[model samples]
Target: MRATVIGAGLAGCEAAWQLAERGVSVTLCEMKPKKYSPAHSYEGFAELICSNSLKASRLESAAGLLKHEMELLGSLLVRVAKENAVEAGGALAVDRKGFSDGVTREILGHPLITVVYDEITEIPEGEVVIATGPLTSDSFAQQIKKLCSSEYLSFYDAAAPIVSFESIDRERVFFAARYGRGDDDYINCPMDKAEYEAFHEALVSAESAPLHEFDQQLKVYEGCMPVEVLAKRGQDAIRYGPLKPVGLTDPRTGRRPWAVVQLRKENRAGTLYNLVGFQTNLKFPEQKRVFSMIPGLEHADFQRYGVMHRNTFLDSPRLLEQDMSLKKDSHIYFAGQITGTEGYMESAAGGILAGINLARKLRGQAPLILPADTMTGALVGYITDETVKDFQPMGSNMGILPPLSERVRDKKKRYGMLAQRAMDSLKAYLQEQGL
Candidate 1:
């Protein structure tokens, strides 16, 4: 059998790989160089348009467990990501360019995969996967809307700024991770009350970039909320939100700082680091002026300024089946952020299942519907649950999984047990299905 997977993003690449490996001919389509999304610039597949880090990588964490599950299912992205991994303390960070280039090589090298470069304005016939992503082109988005007969819900998401490590004042910063989790993997810029107050004042007053016509009436996603927008909520809002100094003592002061700004490694070379929780839509000059107020970043060289863009997702609960196929048409499947599975890895996992289920159906085999207790399964369940009203995008988290019979109060121990249960359930289910 043959399949057409549109949009050679993380989801489309994952989906195309799964089908090809399972003895299906795949046509993977991408629209780059010809057209670019507001956030995308790289002319490569599986581009890391946002942060380079893929959240925490410890098996006890939700993101880590979900990745382990994907590895079990022969995830192409996960394998390539680890090979291109950068030092991110307890998280999995990759050199963005290296990771995307690696993925492009793998997908293009696959014997059963054929790549096509064009904008798909209309849905294809027969077996098809729509992984067009959140910043889908207007022409194609309208086609999707007509296909589902449901209005797409959207929210604004922002990217943080990256500063050159050499430009950061070493005298003003200390290297340490939160609660000493990593081996001094982060550069912490401590702030006294006076400094923090001044920064907050400037951030709230900074001029933001004007929104596009489609982006008016802005609704921001809490996960990627611009630091400036969050600051306007109240004076101490950011202190509790992004600048919280709950852990780590400043060696210079011998006490916890009033607030702190963290810079995380953006590549393996450690030449660049992104301001943690500093996503913004401020004017370029305003960003430089306001952000420089931070102690270590007084003269920081910005490699890339912060930007905000419109992100659109379907009301998946009302329109998609558990396998990520349209309720009205089983031949068409949706993946990625467009299907309401948010975050980088979550989108890839959705694609894995959509491809597996579609390929299996063609072979007259049972669909591999994961157990609800698994992180991947729970995420799919949330998106497809018919009762979910006012649907929003969701990412991997321990809270979404089925609760354990035994209550463990300690947060770490509780998460550990939960992770263990999820893994066992996924393994057992896969074994039963002979996968």
Candidate 2:
């Protein structure tokens, strides 16, 4: 069987790879180098426009378990991510360009995968997976809207600013991971009470770039809320959120500061670092002026300013099945952020399921509907749960997984048990299905 996969982002690449791996010829479509989205500038496939971190790499953590599950399911992107990973303490951070280049090579080199450079203006007939990302092009987005026959729910998502490593004032900042987690992989800017208050005032009062008229009624996703919008919530709100100083003591002060701003490595070379949890829609000048107030960034050179953009996703509960295929049309599948499975890995997982189930269907085999206990299955279940009323995009989290039969008092212990159970369940299911 032949399959068409649109958009060569993480999800599209995974979907096309999986389909090709299962003996299906794939026509992978990408508009990049021919066209560009407002947020995407990289000519390579699977570009990481936002923060490069793929969250934590520990199995007990939500992201870790989800990635582990994907690895088990033969995820191509996950494999490439590890090969190009940068030091992120416990998280799986990758060099964006290197990772994208790696994925582009693999996909283009695949024997059964044929690359087509074009902006897909319409949903193609036959088996297809729409993995176009959240910032899908206008004409193609319209095609998706027509296909689903539903209004798209959109929210404003933001990316944090990146700064040069040499620009950071090392005298004012200290290198340390939270609680000494990794190898002191983070550059922390400590703030005293007076400094934090001053920063907070500037952040909340900073002028934001004007949004388009249609985007005036902004619905910010909680996961990627702009720092400025978050600061407006209250004075101490940022301290508790991104700028929290729960861990680490400043070597100069010998005490934990009132607040801290963390800069995580953006690439393997450690030349560029992004403001951790500093997603913002602030005007470029405002961002520079306000962010410079941080102890370590007084002379920081901004490599890239933070930006907010409209991210569109489908109401999957009403439109999609557990297999990520459209409920109205089984042959048509949806994957990635467009299907409302938020995070990078979550979207890739969606693609894996879509590809696997579609391949199985073609071979006249039963679809693999994983149990809810597993992270991937739970995420898939949540997106397709028709009982949901107000559906929003969801990323992988332990809360979404089915609870343990017996609750453990310790959070770490409980998470470990949950991860083990998920792994065991997935193994058994795959074995039973002969997959």
Instruction: Give TM per candidate.
Output: 0.69, 0.69
**Pairs of colliding residues, candidate 1:** none
Give the per-residue lDDT of model 1 (tens digit) for 89-131. 9999999999999999999999999999988898999999999
lDDT of 2 by residue, 358-399 (tens): 888888888889998899998888788776554556667676
Model 2 clash pairs? none
lDDT of 2: 0.86
Question: What is the TM-score (0 to 1) of candidate 1?
Answer: 0.69
